[model samples]
Each structure stands twice: as C-alpha cells, then as structure tokens.
Target chain A: MVARITFESVHAGQQLPRLDVPITASLIVAGAIATSDFSLVHHDKAHAQAAGTPDIFMNILTSNGLVQRFVHDWAGPGARIKGLKMRLGAPNFPGDAMQLSGTVTAKEVIGQDRIVEVAVSGKNRLGEHVTATVRLALP
Target chain B: MSGTEKNNWLEKVRAMVGREALPPQTAADPVNLPMIRRWCEAMGESDPKYLDGTAAPPAMLFVWTMGHFRAGPGREGGTLLGLDLVEAAGFTSVVATNVEEEYLRELRCGDVLTQRITLDAISEEKKTGLGVGHFVTYRYEFSDQKGEVVGRTLFRVLKFRPPAKTNETAARVDTDTAGVTQPLHPRPAITRDGAFFWEGLNQRKLLVRKCGSCGRLHHPPGPMCPDCNSLEWTTQQCSGRGRIHSFVVVHQPQIPGFQYPLPVALVDLEEGVRIVANLRDIAPGKVRINMPVEVEFVEVGKDFVIPAFRERQAG
Candidate 1:
C-alpha cells in the first residue's frame, strides 16, 4: 500500500510533484462510455466534426477523474477529499499531453482532522486545460 | 472567430444564465449494489467499504444525479438548448471542462434522491486551444426524499468551434465489452422465519404473516408479530395493491445485471402492511409519492424471482 500523508507533514505553500499524462482518443472515449455518458461528441467522430470540433474530445467526467487521481496520489490513500471546485479553460483533445500540478494553499484543523485546500491546474501543450481547488482531510 | 460574431453569440446564449436549464426530477433507482459495482470497476477502485455495501464512495456523489440512457424527457438540464444556442452561433463543439461536488452525507441503498438545477454563469467569448467559445456553468442541488441536502455540484463545459480537422484519422468507434456481464443481486438471507417469504415469492404470491392470536399482520415473516408479540403465525396472501409510501431513484456504483437509475419503493400495502421492493412499468422520474401500485414478481435469474411493483391503472 502507498504510504499515507499525515496532517503534521503538510503546510501551506507546498508544491506537489507534477505528473505528465498522455491524452488519447481511446482515453477520451473510454471515460464517456465508462461513466455512461452517451453524448455523441465524446466518441462519434463524424458527429463531433459536424458539431464543430476537431475530433472527439475528453468529457468532464474523465477530466474530473484525472483531477481526483492527481490529488489522491499526492495526498495518499487515507486522505479524504472534502470538496472540489473546477473550471474548464482549454480542450483536452486526443493526441495532446496534460501535465497536472498543485500547491497547498491553506490548512486548518477542523474537528478531528486537518483540512487542507490545494489549488491545482492541468495544462496541455495548447495551454491550461483545467483549474480547480480541492479540499482534503488528513489525519 | 471574429470579434463581432463572438459578441453576438455570447449575447444570444447569455439569456439562459439565470433560467432553469434542467427541471427537477427524481432518480430512477435507489442506491443499489449493481451500479456501485460498475462504478468501482470503471474507476479501478477497490475500496472494501463499497464492495461490502458499507458506504458508497463520496466521489460518486454526482453519479446519483445522472439520468440513464432510456431516461425520459425533461430529465436532462445541463446540456439543454443553451448548448444549442452556442452551436448555432458557430461555436459548434462542446466539452465538459470542470466539475466540483461537495458531499454532505454517505449514500446508501434505498435512499431516493431528488435534484433541482439552475444555470449559474456563462462566460464571454474567449479564444482557447480548442477554438473560440464560451464557458457555461450549472449549479445542482441534491436532496434525499426527506428533503435533506445530500450534496451540491457546480459543473462547467466549454462550447467552442473546433479547430480545422486536426486528427489525420477519424475517431474510432469502440465495441469493447470484454468482461462485462449483468450483475446478480445479493441473494436474500433466508432464515427459518423468512424462508416462507422467499418461498412465497418463488410461488408468485405476496404473503404477509398474520398473528394466529391477534390477526395483526407483519411483513418479512417475523418469528413473532410486532403488534401482538405472538409466536404462532400464519401467512395471508396479499391483494398486491398499494400506494408508494416512499421511494428513491439510485444512480451510483454502476453494478452489472441491472439498469441505471433503478427505482426502489416502500409500498403501503392494502393489507395494512408495508414492504420494500423495486418499482417498475413507469419512468423513474414519473413516479410520484402516494401513487397507486401493484405487486408483480420479476424473474431475475434461474429459479430466483423478486417482488417488484408497477403503477396501478386508475379506474
């Protein structure tokens, strides 16, 4: 099992390690089908083209999963995500690369656990793909 | 991507920001085992709590709000005509960019959820790597049947014009169901007292045990009647007519062997006994509290059947 992060070890202004992820057509489509999102734009090339996109692109569910994975991997297994707020900035199309990074913005002791807030961003070659804030609890 | 066109497009679609993009609707199913299994499989999550039916993963909070493929009209709010408006303005492509959810409680089986959605914000035209478009956001409020707030979410998607045919080849259609199968529900745990209830279901009969001493009835074939506390009891066939006492549409954990948005209900039987069962023959969103229903047995697997309810026809 991966080692867990303790509340005492984390502090504001700490930067998490960055991870580079290669985006693919299959990755984008797999996310849609897995989440039961049947929108044509996420998988159908002809339909997506007609809808005015370069190709089928990643869905929000996939982006959310990526974001979740990015944070949990850093916070370790025992950490609980309290909340997440995100905004889409760029498209994550197939054949592009996404690099995810984050910084601890604030930490406070709430009840029995330490609640740490992190500002995270996913950027691709085109530019920023996703930006969001995630709240997690560490014991 | 001209300035004049972008301005015009934003102006037309911006009118929807304060409107109800999606109508309030009930979930089709209560939280169940089948959907939960599927979600875990997809996400590669192996949390023991989910598998043992202890607590659903908090990340799945949004899944309970989703409408299934065969879902009826007015059930979808986020991608309503607002997206169409942007598409018409030549911002023809759309992709979900962001999602944030705050879970207030753990979802469990048999908990019915109702959700209301409001369009929150629409960004002005902006140029991005994908193309020139606007970002639209929706705020979703989820509550259980008791009207307790379960969770809230803010979702954002970008509607943009696609960059010129970028990928040399078209997107491939995938037909990859390598290891997927229908999920068999957890079998009923039959004890000496409950054995008769299971047997009744297999016999296509809905039975409520009646106290031999007091004639007071109790469902689930208890050893002793609750009201009279009598050990001796006999079973009585039910009339199968009832009203929906309470219900919940389950959305999460995507377990196999069942459909999404499954509706489970607590029925107030005409015999004055209450039983919990799956509701059928009606759209999950269309089921109303106190709606009349009748019991029916559905054959799920070989030699196994479960009681399900259907909307009763009005006289």
Candidate 2:
C-alpha cells in the first residue's frame, strides 16, 4: 500500500522530489508497450534509424504516463488525477536519462474536494522532452 | 542484380497486392484480465475500471493480435508478414514508418479475435542514408467471434538494402535471403554433467538429480549436491507437474531465434525442485504466481527440441 498526502499538507510554490529515469533500450521498449503505443519508432532500432531517428525513443503516450506517475507517486494512492495535458519537444532516445521535476502551481477547495494543479517538466541531455500540467484531487 | 531481374522483381511484388500477406491467423489467447492487469500494472494505471477487469484498454488492439511463433514457413520464424519475399529481392532491413487505426467495438474477456492482413501499396525505389528501397504498406483488419470488424490498422514499413561499406567496418549479412528455414529456437548448451538432463528431453521425460548420501533432490543435474556435499547422485523421473514460482515477458535485444515478448518461467515442481524454462500454449498475460503448469516437449525446428512449460488444467 502507498501512503497518502493530505490536501492541507500540500502548498503552492512547493517543489516535488526529483526522479531520474535511466533511458535504457529496455525501458523505452517496455514503456511504449505498457502504454499501448504499438509503433516501431518506439521499439525497433533499425526501423527508427531508417525513419531518420538514431534509435528507439520514448513515445508521447509513455511520456504522458511517466508524468502521471511522477504526480501520483508524489500525491500517493489517495490522489486522483482530474486532468493531464502535455507538450513534447526533444526525443528521449536510449542512452539518455530523463530528469522529471515538478512544482505545485495552485490549489483550490471545492466542497469536500481539494484540487491541486502541478506544473511538470521532464528533461534529458538534449533538452526538455515533455512539459505538462497535471490537475489532481487530493484527500 | 541485372536490369531484367530488377523489373521482374517488382512485377512479382506487384502481383501480391490485394492478396493475403500471410495466412489468416487467430489470437493465441482470448482477451482476458491477466494480460490487462499486467499492462495496467506496468503503466501504473490503478483505475477501478481496469482493476475490475471488465473492459480492455482501447490501445491493446494491436497487441491482442500479436501472433505466436509457428515452426516453418515464409515468415521470419513465424513473424514479419511474409516479408521474406521482399528481403529476398534485396530489401533486407525494414523500419515501420507510420500507422493509423480505427476502433469500432470494445474488446472484453472471453472474446477470441482473428486477423487478416493485405498488402495494400508499394512505392517506387527511393534513396536514403540506409540504402535504396521501397515503402510497403499493409492493411490489417481484426474481427471478433461474430465476424464483425472490431478494429483496423494501416501499417507502413520502409524495407531497404543496407548501405554498402568497406571491409574494415562492414558488418552486414550477405543478402542470400532464402526461404528462412533457419532454426527458430536457441540450442541448449550441452555439457558433461548436464548431458543427462537434455537426454531426458530426447526421450520425453523429466529428470531430477538425487543426492546418493541424503536423498536430497536438486535441479540442473549438477555433479555435486549442495545440501549433503555428495559427489554421488542418480536420476529420478519426474511427474512433470509444477506451479509457476515466477516469470517474465522478455522484449529487448530481439534475439533472432525467438519471438519478442517471450514468456519465461521458474517452475516449482511437485517433486520439490525448481527449473527454468519457456512457457507455451498461453499468452504472457495469462502467466500467474502459483498457477499450475506441466512440462511439454516442443520441437521448434529441425531436431531442435526444447523443454517448455504449459498450463495444466486444474482438477
């Protein structure tokens, strides 16, 4: 079981803990599969290279998932995601590492529910790969 | 290699259009909870909708249609959609370039699915960093038990001949491109002490080693026993009954002799010894901890039989 973070304990302008993901070929391949992005660019190296990329890279869906996980892992099982949107930039290829960082941007109270909006960014050596805003409801 | 040969090659390929790329096939396992659960767990999706196991994720359409390895044929060891014909003509390496899909109905547990793929289009010769090749596209349609279309996908691939290189840096395989009769399974490393174990597989039996001093049974047929330090040992025929202790679905480093997302398991035998082998007659999503299984000998290629495990029906 996972521990939960109460709405009262979270504050705007607070920084969440950082997570570094080692972008191995296996992780890239498995992450794409877990998200149901059954494209060759995310799994087959020869295919990716022929298509212009150097090797298999993380798919946008997997990036969205990695962000969702970053938020939930910080907010805990008690947290529920209300909305999530992202913009992808650099391609996260194998042999690179992604540093996922986030900050609480705002908080609100609606009836018995407390809604929190978090701004998240995942970066690699090339640059930022994904920038997103995650809105979650905390207990 | 000559002008007339080049023209005839494309003519042969052109005739395959609107034809079945490979023989019609069915999903190895029906849409079920275990596979759905595994995907959810890996993606960190804890939604009650999926946890309750009613509806499968819409994204699993292609995965559900992934085929199993069938010994012998035009496919690259039962994969690749008869692309050997393309490879034989000179385009040996392939890369998927694009895909578009549409979903018509939701897939649920107990729904068995089948697929039909047709070669839809082929492009003229193009030059690139990799080499000169053509862009081949196929249309895939998936149907359910009632023969209603559930989903469709347009898949495109760029098949090219690898760029030429000098001897000092060349690593390309010769484009012999025969009908892919290569062995489809990796051979077990037979050794002096482990010879009996493989020999048992030849005779369709499972063997465990018993320590002559204390009667302790062990797996892998080692020369010495860990429990009693006994140099003496003998063989015991096993019942081949077991339960899955642990397992994994391997997807990386794409070994040629096997399929991707291969399911391998550590099976705890009823005789109290554990052995590792591949799983058969089931999908990766169907494997579970403590589930009952039995040993099965499958001949994956010419005289290349390997020991694998299959689900044992509960009594």
- Encode model 1's per-residue lDDT on B70-162: one tens digit a residue: 656745435564777777777766677778899777788778888888888888778775567788888888899899998888877777776
The digit string of per-residue lDDT tens for model 2 on B96-204 reads: 5555555566578988888888989888788753468888988889999888888877777778886533211221112226622221243454667887887787788
Candidate 1 off by > 4 Å: A15-24, A52-54, A94-97, A111-113, A124-127, B1-17, B71-91, B127-129, B161-315
For candidate 1, what is the total of clashing residue pairs? 23
What's the residue-level lDDT of B232 in candidate 1? 90
Docking class of 2: incorrect
TM-score for all models, in order of appearance: 0.57, 0.44
**lDDT string, candidate 2, A84-134, tens digits:** 556666678776789999999999987766989899999886668888887
Q: Tell me what TM-score chain B of candidate 2 gets against the true chain B.
A: 0.49
Each candidate's DockQ: 0.15, 0.06
Interface RMSD of each: 8.8, 10.1
The 10-residue segment of model 1 chain B with minimum total lDDT is B167-176
All models: lDDT? 0.76, 0.74
As a whole number from 0 to 100, the lDDT of residue B161 in candidate 1 is: 71
TM-score, cand. 2 vs. native? 0.44
